[model samples]
Target: MDYRLEQDLLGDKNIEVSSYSGINTARALENFDLGGKTVNLHLIKEIALIKKAAAMTNKKLKFLQEDKADAIIKASEEVIDGKFDNEFKVSAFQGGAGTSTNMNVNEVIANRAIELLGGAKGEYDLVHPLNHVNMSQSTNDVYPSALRIAAIRLIRKLSTSLSSLQEALQIKENDFADIIKLGRTQLMDALPMTAGQGFGAYAKAIERDRWRIYKVEERLRQINLGGTAIGTGLNATNRYVFMMTDIIQDLTGLGIARSDYPMDITQNCDIFVETSGLLKSCSVNLLKISNDLRLLNSGPRGGFGEIILPKMQAGSTIMPGKVNPVIPEMVAQVSLRVISNDTAITMASSMGQLELNAFVPLIAECLLESLELLDRSVVLFKEKCIDDLLMDKDRCLENLENSLVSATALVPYIGYDKASLVSKKALSSGKTIREILLEEQILPIETIDKILSPNELIRTHISGK
Candidate 1:
């Protein structure tokens, strides 16, 4: 492969001749080569967007030449459009609070702009990375602002995925609306409820979490884009500071605005913490819903077998015809990982000792990972499991009939002591409460029918009716 020489404060290094990145990115490659991990490309694109917005604003203010700014914007737009993905090599877990990642983007844009201007790559004389591309930004503000934009983009994706999932689950709920099933408390049968009730609860949780994600997105709209270095807007003009955010909002079509106190936005990473915490809530909800599906689909003959998940794959090589709830299982595992990521982010958020969080790279990395993981997991769960879910009506009714705990429904009418007597007799003789009640002539047949109806029971549970 052909190579070109590039220089930074640390001196020169050999970079690939065809590469857009220069010395700083090369130094990052040498320093932070931990398992070939790199910053997410979405984040790099966000950084590029920041560069484009700043350059356009600077050009308007005459802080930068229009030709140079146009070239930089053109180059930055390419990165934002997902070109030169291979140029960003800085690891997600790195030192310098993401300066390496920031410089990597700056250099890639600068070199690409040089090429756009009919100059050779790495020829900073044409469009220098720091002097032109990074004219009015610092790693501190730029990195956090980029992270916020990246997160907003991701949250919108997650919200879309979740909305689809919730709608799919609601469809299943409606389809299963009348299917009577035995509800459980502490893993034992409790009372009669429609399968729809269970699925509706899952849908409700997702809807609630989706709203939470929207709220967090609004919180992240507060950014410190032009707060150069330490949030004082040092080394950047006021016009650039104010106009840059407007340009960014216009470009991204997001509700991003300049922070009221750039120091507050720069010195703290808690907004990310709060956003990730909401993501954690989403993970927990998925865990609960998936675990419930797994349990319901546990066995054909021995386990609950109340519902059948789509046969994604055979459960075991040894166990013939053993299909598993693979999609829900996948969701459960992803949820656990998201929970772990949130914990790490909480610790990383507290790592800010002064005006900057040195651990922001990890925070950004983990947040993006969790978002992508959940977004894909939810879509997969919906398509592979919920979309094709099938209720075992016979099994559900059988379980509902055999559940001794159904005696609780009778207690409200027959009194607890008498219901307990009826329950004991049914348990001893392996009979159902319906049978015992009929033999005892405990109440009118109409009352017994009304008492055991799943819809009525669910309504009573929900509305105290």
Candidate 2:
């Protein structure tokens, strides 16, 4: 355990000689130890990108010497490549609006740059964290901009996963196109529908989610990267301020733009809230679809049992030969967790003060976690559950015939009053609607068969009379 002394405004502390983090990061490690949950690696990598862009911009502006800029650029690239990931030890729940995380990145980049420049790790004189690596940047601008970058990258991934999930549903929809089943509303029988129609509806909902997530990436593209401190580019030159976004865009290969009102972008965080709300909407659809699948796959013996999910694992400790709808259940839980993360993100976004939001780290944590969780869960759901789904055609027909739901189709010919009478009679006598209708001679056998035919009953479009 050899160490080197690193000094900050507070005092001096011994940093490990081999560590690539400086005094600020060391202080942050000691100050904010909330549950040992480190900042997201995506955020760290994006911030490193920002630092790299800033160094290049500074060198172009002649603010940093070429040698120092090159060292910092190389170090920042290493950080972006995750070579120094273990050095970012700050908590994700830290205060100062992610200043701790920002400084942690700065220190790691600076120390790594120092080592690259043939200087000792703690040699700030050669490559100072703030003066060299964080030139023309502040946590206020850098942190939020980096967060947007990380979030947009992750949002793209989520959109892709949603697309895959939608495709899986569409495949199932086609496979089950002719398998007629009972449609339930309010936990009661409603009408007859093909299992394909049900899966088609799920696919449509997920398609909307995919588009929503894809469109929201546009909102995140406008950033306030040069609005250092309080959206007033005080220490940063006008040239640097104007050039930052273009440099960052080129470096990260994202279609990012500078904010029209950097102050507004710096002060407000509602974009994140809006993004989280969209995620919650997607989660709502996922929860609904998962519940529907669970119901469709409910029981081979006792439940609706209209369809069977892939047998993932044993359902119970004591029940032999029992399998559970584990993938849908996992999808349901992930959706609920994403919903909860949305709530936290909403709260954290709304709690920002006049000029800066100190709660962005929490927002980043929850939002990134939600995105990753949904992406993985959706892929698992599609591969493990939706793709291998099996329909119990007999069970579907049995449930459809056992219920009085088909009485609604009788209304077109027999009128509503007659339909209700038929339903009531079928319920009371424990007979099916078709049986009761035929017994009472409500309609001719030819007409009755025409009305209750699966093709005639499940017609999605109406024919003009």
* Highest TM-score model number: 2
Tens-place lDDT digits, model 2, residues 48-123:
9999999999999999999999999999999989888888778888888999898898998998888888999888
Give the C-alpha miss distance for residue 240 in model 2, angstroms. 1.1
List residue ranges in candidate 2 displaced over 4 A: 460-465
Candidate 1 lDDT over residue span 156-267, tens digit each: 9999999999999899899999898889989977777899989899999999999899778888998887788889988887888889988998999999999989988888
What TM-score number comes out for model 2? 0.97
Listed in order, each prediction's TM-score against the native is: 0.95, 0.97
* Ten-residue stretch with the least lDDT total in model 1: 456-465
